[model samples]
Target: MTQTTQTDRTTTGAIPVPARTGVHELDPAEAQSAREVALRLVATAGAVVDDEKWISAAAAAWQELPLSLRHAVRAFRRHSGSRGTLLLRGLPVAVDELPATPGHGSSVQRRATVPAALIMAVASGLGDPIAFAPEKSGAMVQDVVPVAGREEFQGNAGSVRLSYHNENAFHPHRPDYVLLICLRPDHDRIAGTSTACVREVLPLLSPAGREALHAAEFTTAAPPSFGAGGERAGAHAVLTGPASDPDLRVDLAATRPLTARAERALSELADVFETVGRTEVLTTGDLVIVDNRVAVHGRSRFTPRYDGSDRWLQRTFVAADLRRSRSHRADDGHVLI
Candidate 1:
């Protein structure tokens, strides 16, 4: 897909905000095959989503997927392009039998469903699923829906324009990939999930702006959902690792520049994101995988009725290697303590 960027710094942001209109969809046969595997795993797991054997079985099934599909998933896992996002449409999500969108969060029953199993199957292709103990009862898959009282809040439950952010940016064990599966879309179909890749925005940065972002002059506060309250993380660079294609870790809603120069640099970066970020309106059976290290994601504002038919999405955090967080987990489990 082609999109133009608005470069007028006075009127437009540094990056031109555009919507992603293209998708990488699976063929009908592939979708059916994936559904069969997912349903089999769901039946085997029964009502237990946290069982190690069940998860392992799901992973093993993922390995048996068609080589072509596996290769595509692996390529994205290794390196996403300037968009830093992969949209897979027509994955088998058993929506007809799905219960009403959970207004609160994921439950064991929901986790054992076919859609959840499909998510786990896809995640196995990328990495190990992980969750934080303080969030959503440490369930590996979290239900994203607009909560009744959190409409204006900048969080998963809010219907407002959520600021772009790396998943769990303040945590040392933050996820490497954020997998979101759409079970139900917003009524108006206008609620788009936005993503901005540092790869795309880096070219727009001035040398001074790039230098400032590479320095350790920014601090990010832990979102309230993490239960850290007002806790802030140590000083760190907004961009780090290799200079050619650095990693990104900034939460527009929670990050703060620690100096005057850093503040100006951050403002410039924000403009770049606004000018280039792309939004995608997810549909049922669509899974959007994001490289959390190379890009940030947020959601656009949309009205939610709070009725049973509101938008619904399931999210999971994944790491390329789970062993890195061994010390932060119990029995070296998926849940990060």
Candidate 2:
């Protein structure tokens, strides 16, 4: 673990850089316990992860995971510390046993694989897992692999430097937690998943910048992953809730400032994010959970060989309060329309 912090710009006054957190590494025994739990889930869930019965089974299996793992996740759900990110290393992912990374767009794991079971079980512990109808066919577990022709795109299929964004920022019922489990690293191991929390960034912003961000002067359009006819958020504040510890809601790629002051504020916010953000190069069996309400996440640029073994990470979204989006979900299911 390295300690890296950026100095605040002289023009913007002094910005305090928070201490970096260490990865929570599971011992061999704990890892094995998790593996058994996930394997049992695979047996019970059968071959369909999207089935409501599978989700119910996963929720039951969540209690069977290692007590340490469950405790960590429960504490994070209560308060996500200064970084608003939790990285757990040494889960139960069998890298060598996995099939070739999918190269197609909108890839999702509908089958009840080991990795899929592990993520879904954890998702149930944190909250109910949810997905957008327009994104990745509304599957709970989605593949975060690079697609052949979408190298320059901003979404999951791209290998470029993805700008920081709150996942599904334009949606009224956006996810509260975003979980990514790394099954394979890039060939060069340079693709870093970075996160910046508003807690760490608020001090770096100017008074005027903070005020402008709090005002309803921004609109966010749905990302390319949503395709055509996706809904957009209108006239929303980039920062909401208590000014002391406000929630962040801005997508660097999709949010647009409405006024001149708002534009300058957005730029300032971006600068602060770059200054205080932390990047982690994930390895196999590593899981990173970002508090979507407090932090925005993105990825660093990495070259994809397009071979069978490119970077492969599976993702799932969790909504802390599933009832809030009941109307958007059909038949009270998880997928939000």
Candidate 3:
């Protein structure tokens, strides 16, 4: 892994910033073991990825995975480490068996597949998988692929550089963990997923900046991904919890500062994030998990051919404690209204 203390100005805009890369690769034997579990899951009867019964089966299959994989995921659930990100390489994705990257917008994986099985199993290890009704039609497994006519859009369908943000930052019941699995890379393999953790940015913040960010002086609106008609978050602190290690809750593209000092603080926070952020170019079978409570994530710009070979990634959101959001979910279902 690489580290830089110098501040980077390019990241203040949409340009990609130089970043440290770290990954935990599974051995051939371990990867094969995971593949076996995924194959069995694919063969299960009524293997719909989003159905409550299927989700329960996936959760049960979690215990059948390799011991190493289960241990690593459980440990991450307890503590996300200093970077608040974990990249697991060599998962059981059968690239040759996959279909063409979805060309339409709001693509989701409803049928069971090897990649879906792997992602859902991991989601069960972290927590129960959850989804918002307004986002991606409340699908448990959504496709993060570029779509035609949405190149400049800010959501998953766009190929442009996405700004740093906690997934669903405007929602009171935001995901505690965001899981993304790579099924295919972009034509150029240059598109990188980046993350910046508050643990690293906290130490670099000025006393005044920290004070301002801790106050309830920021408001965040819903992103384009959620469409329209959602309520915006009221005045809230960008950083919360203990000062030594605070949780981050602001989207650079949607969060607005309410006061002059708050504005300066927000700018300073962005700069510090740029200074410490890291980007990783994920490959097939790679799974990156972001601790949403402690870090903000984004993507670097990439040109999508719009052909059948565009980059393809599958995403799932996890709630560490599902019971906390019971009121928002109707009939104790996974989809939150």
Candidate 2 clashing pairs, residues 3+ apart or interchain: none
lDDT of 1 by residue, 67-117 (tens): 556766787877777788888888888678878877863332335777778
What are the per-model C-alpha RMSD values against the true structure? 10.4, 9.9, 10.6
Q: Any runs in candidate 1 off by more than 4 Å, and if so which?
A: 1-23, 105-110, 228-230
Q: Quick one: RMSD of model 2?
A: 9.9
lDDT of 2 at 76: 82
lDDT of 3: 0.91
- lDDT of each residue in 25-121, candidate 3, tens digit only: 7899999998988888888889899889989989988999887677677777777878999898999787888889999888899998999999999
Q: Give each model's whole-structure lDDT.
A: 0.84, 0.92, 0.91
Rank ordering of all candidates by lDDT, starting from the highest: 2, 3, 1
What ordering of candidates by TM-score runs from best to worst?
Answer: 2, 3, 1
What is the per-residue lDDT of model 2 for residues 288-309, given as tens digits with 9 covering 90 to 100? Answer: 9999999999999999999889
Mark the 10 consecutive residues where model 1 has the least summed lDDT: 1-10
